[model samples]
Target chain A: MVEPLRHVTPFWPAFWRGFRALMPLWLGIIPFAVAYAVTARAAGLGVGETQLMSLTVFAGASQFAAAGLFAGGASAWGIVATTFLLNARHVLYGLSLARQVPLTRPERVLAAQFLTDEAYGVTVVHGAREPGGLSFGFLLGAELSLYAVWNAATFAGALAGAVLPDPAALGVGVVFPLAFLGLLVPLLVDRKAVIVALASGLGAWGLSRVLPGGLVVLLAGVGGALLGAVLVTRRGEA
Target chain B: MSVPLVTLLMWLVTYPARLLGLSLGRLKLPPFWLAFLRFVPVSVFAALIVPDVLGSPEWPRRLVGCAVGVGLMWRTRNLALGILGGFGAYWLARLAGL
Candidate 1:
C-alpha cells in the first residue's frame, strides 16, 4: 500500500536522496568540468584565476566563451556582455522552479547560487515525481553534489593541464549533448512536446546563423514556449 | 582591467540574472504563461543538443552514441545507464575508427 505523503522528509535522507539522483549527471559533468579547466588554462588564465572563475562564476558555457574571448583579446566589457547573454536562460530556469520549490527568502537566495542546467533538470524531475511537493533538502543535496564534483574536477584538470590530450579526440565533447539528450528524450511524452522540441531545435539552429552567442538559444526558447502554450490551450479546448 | 575585476563583473551580471526570477516568486502567473514555462526545460535542452549533434565532426559516432543513450533510457528508465551507454558507445566508435 502506498504511504501517505509526509509534509517533510528528514533532512539527511532527503539530502542524500538528492545527491544520489544526480550521480548520473555527474558522469557528464565530470568531463565537461575538466575540459573547461583545461581550456581556461590553455587560454592564458592563471591557475588562481581559473579556479576562482570555476568556484565563483559556475556557469559553463559563459565561462568557456569568456575564456575564449579573453584569449582573443576581447575587451572586458565585451566578455561580460557575452557572459550575461549566455546566462540569461537561467532566469527562465529560476522562474519555472520558483513557485514549485518553496523556500524562505534567504534559502531561495542560497538555492539560486547553485542553480545550473543540471541541477534545474534534476529538480524538475524530482518535483514531478515527489508526492510530497518540492523538497528543499533534495534540491540542496543535488546542487551541493554537483557543485562539489564540478570544483574537484576543475581543480584536477587545472593541475593536469597541458598533459591531457585533446578532449574532443576522446569523444568527451559528445558527453554533454548526449547527457542533455538523456534528460530530454524522457520528457518528450506527447505530440505537443515532440513538436515543440523539434521546432525549438530548428529555430535555434537557424538563429545561430545570424544571432550572437546565447541570443539564439534565448530566442528559440521563447518561440518554443509560445508554441507549446498555444498547443496546450488548443488541446484543452479540444 | 585586471583579471580579478573582470571576474567580479562577470559574477555581478551573471549571478543577478539567475536570482531575478526567484525574487518574483510571489507574483502569480497566468495559466497560459505557466504552461509555457512548463515547456521551457524541453525547449532549453533541445536548443542545447541539436546544434552540437548536427554540427559534430564525428556525426556517425555521435549519432550512434545518442541512439545507445535513448535506447538504454527507454529500456531501463535509468539515467546513469543511459549516460554510461552513450559515453561508452562514443568511445568505442572512436576506437573502432568510425
Candidate 2:
C-alpha cells in the first residue's frame, strides 16, 4: 500500500521536468501560430474565432492545413475531412500508446482531448523510461504547459494577423516549411529512415497537386513504411 | 466560426477519435507501423514546416534562420533550442527587412 504511494511521489517532479523541457520548443511554435492566424483570418474566421480554433483544436499542423483549405474556398465538410486525414497519425499514436497506459473508458476519453505532438512525445519518452510509473500529475503537467504555450502563441498570432500585412508577401510563409524541413532532416538517422522520409516528402509534394484530397500524404506515409519493412527484412536475412 | 463554438466542436470530435484509437479494433497495426508512429511527430512537424520555409520569397533570410536552428540543435541536442532559434532568426530577419 505504502509502496504504491511512494512510487507515485516522483510523478510531479517528472511532470515538471517534462514541462521545463518543452519551454524552448514553444519558441519555434510562435511563427506557426502566427501563420495560423494569417490563414485563419483569411479564411473568414474572426480574430476571436481564430483564437478559439487554436485553443480548441490545439493540433498545429491540422489547424494550418484546415485554415489553408478554408482560405482556398473549401467547404466546412471539406475542411473537416482534411483535418481528419492530416490528423490520422494521432490515431496511430493512441493505438500504440494504449498498450502502455491502460486507461479506463472515461479516462481514455478524457486523455484523447489533449493528445498533441508535445504530449505524445513526452508521454512516450517518459513512459519508456519508467513504464507504468508515470503518474497523472506528470502527464497533466506536461500537457498543461504545452496547452498554455500553444494557446498563448496562437492568441498572439491572431492578434498580429488582424493588423500585420500579408505574411505571404513579407516572406514569412517560408519560415513554416523551413522549420519543418529542419525537423525532418534530423530524424533521417539511417538508410531506411532516410528513404522513408524522402519518399514520403517527395510523394506528397508530387501527389498533392494531382491527387484529390490528401491521398499524396497517405501514399507517402504508407509507401515509406512499406519500404522500411522491406529494408529491415532484407537486413535481417543477412 | 465563433471561438467557443470551435472549442466545443473540438471537445466533441477529438474525444471520440481518441476513444476510437483505444477501442480494440480490427486494424492490424504491424511492428513497422508501430515504429513509424514513433516518428509521427517529426513527420508531422516536417510536413507542416517545409512548405512555409521553402515557399517564402526571401529564401536567404530563412536559410540563415535554418542554419542557426541546426547549429543550436547540434550544440545542445535540445529540440526547444532548435525550434526557438529558427523562429527567432526568422522574426529578426523579417523585422530587419532582410
Please give the TM-score that candidate 2 achieves against the real structure.
Answer: 0.73
Residue-wise lDDT of candidate 2 within B1-98, one digit each (tens)?
53355445544555566557656423456665555555554444444443334443666677678778778776776666575677578778768888
Clashing pairs in 1: none
* lDDT (C-alpha) at residue A210 in model 1: 77
Question: What are the lDDT figures for the candidates, one per model?
Answer: 0.84, 0.62
Chain A: TM-score in each model: 0.93, 0.75
Worst 10 residues of 2 chain A by lDDT: A1-10
List runs of model 2 lying over 4 Å from the truth.
Answer: A1-9, A38-44, A65-73, A99-104, A122-138, A157-161, A165-189, A211-215, B1-13, B22-68, B84-98
Off by over 4 Å in 1: A1-6, B95-97
Each candidate's chain B TM-score? 0.90, 0.59
Q: Write the per-residue lDDT of candidate 1 for residues B44-89, one digit (tens) a residue.
A: 8888887777666687888788889889988888888888888899
